[model samples]
Target: EAAVTQSPRNKVAVTGGKVTLSCNQTNNHNNMYWYRQDTGHGLRLIHYSYGAGSTEKGDIPDGYKASRPSQENFSLILELATPSQTSVYFCASGDLGGPNQDTQYFGPGTRLLVL
Candidate 1:
């Protein structure tokens, strides 16, 4: 089956540090997204890109950034990582299969821990 995967499945960071989560999708989809899964709010969109060389900040853009240099790769950058930012991050790639329906194939996830 087609899938999305993340690297450094687990991470530990100091109070003021930098962390980057990598993602790669092989499905050849046109859109890529980054999200954080946390309690209470569930999943929240942090960033997304359409095709290659284009990225947009999603709902929550504070303390985070994103890059989409090509169709198959997208990266999430945390300039100044903080403890509150610790959470499970996910990446997804997808395309609209039907009218008003966009199917996003998600990566397993990257777990991050901040001190």
Candidate 2:
């Protein structure tokens, strides 16, 4: 099974403050993704990476940044956090091929509150 973990299960940040959310995957998947879950919007993609040293913008990448330092680590960076950016963030890992292709394994989630 693919295992994914996120840091600082819960967080509180001030407006304009810098916040970083980290994720790690035990399975050596080729793709990693960062998403935010909001009440009515569902899970919206913030950023993703095909592999290490590469990052790509997703659906809602306006105020976030992503880093994939290795096959097992991915980080989400918020240079200037705002209340509007507060939400539950999730990280996922998956591969491109096999029977379970495109199937993502998600982390527990990180709740952020920007005041």
Candidate 3:
């Protein structure tokens, strides 16, 4: 089974402060993604990586940065967090091919509050 974990399950930050959300996966999947889940907008992709040393911008990459330092680690960075950026963030890992090709295993989630 795929295993994924996130740090600081909940957080509180001030406006314009820096915040970082981290994720780690033991599945060794080649693709990793960062997303934010909001009430109306739903799950919106923030960033993703094909593998280590590769970070690609997603639909809503304006205020966030992503890093994949190794096969098991991926991080989402908010240089200057804002109130509008507060939401539940998720991390997922998947492979390009296999029985679970289109399936992504996700972490529990990290809730952030920007005041």
Candidate 4:
């Protein structure tokens, strides 16, 4: 089974401050993703990586950056936090299959508050 976990279940940041969220996966899956869940926006992908040392931008990559230094770790970086960035962040992991690999499992979530 795939297992992904995130740090600092909750966070509070001042506007314009830098915030970093970390993720770690025990599964050896090749795909790792970061998503933010908001009231009406739903879960929007912020970044993802196929494998170690490979970070790719996702649907809502603006105002966010990602790092994947190893297969077991991924990090999301917010250089200048904003009120608009306050949301619930989730880390997910799954193996990419050929034409059918789309199962994604999510972590509990990290609530970020920007003031």
Every model's TM-score = 0.93, 0.97, 0.97, 0.93
Per-residue lDDT tens digits of candidate 1, residues 1-115?
6479788789999877888888998988889999999999999999999888998989998999898888899999998999999999999998866542598889999999999
Most TM-score-accurate candidate: 2
The local distance difference test score of each candidate is 0.90, 0.96, 0.94, 0.92
Q: How well is each residue in 1-115 modelled by candidate 3, as lDDT tens digits? A: 5399998899999999999999999998999999999998999999999999999999999989999999999999999999999899999999999999979999999999999
lDDT digits (tens) for residues 19-56 of candidate 4: 99999989777999999999888999999999999999
lDDT of candidate 3 at residue 32, scale 0 to 100: 96
Pairs with backbone N, CA or C atoms under 3 Å apart (clashes), candidate 2: none
Top candidate when judged by lDDT against the true structure: 2
Poorest stretch of ten by lDDT in candidate 4: 96-105
lDDT by residue for model 2 (11-83), tens: 9999999999999999889999999999999999999999999999999999999999999999999999999
Better of 1 and 4 by lDDT: 4
Clashing pairs in model 4, backbone N/Cα/C closer than 3 A: none
TM-score of 2: 0.97
How do these models rank on lDDT, best leading? 2, 3, 4, 1
Any runs in candidate 4 off by more than 4 Å, and if so which? 98-100
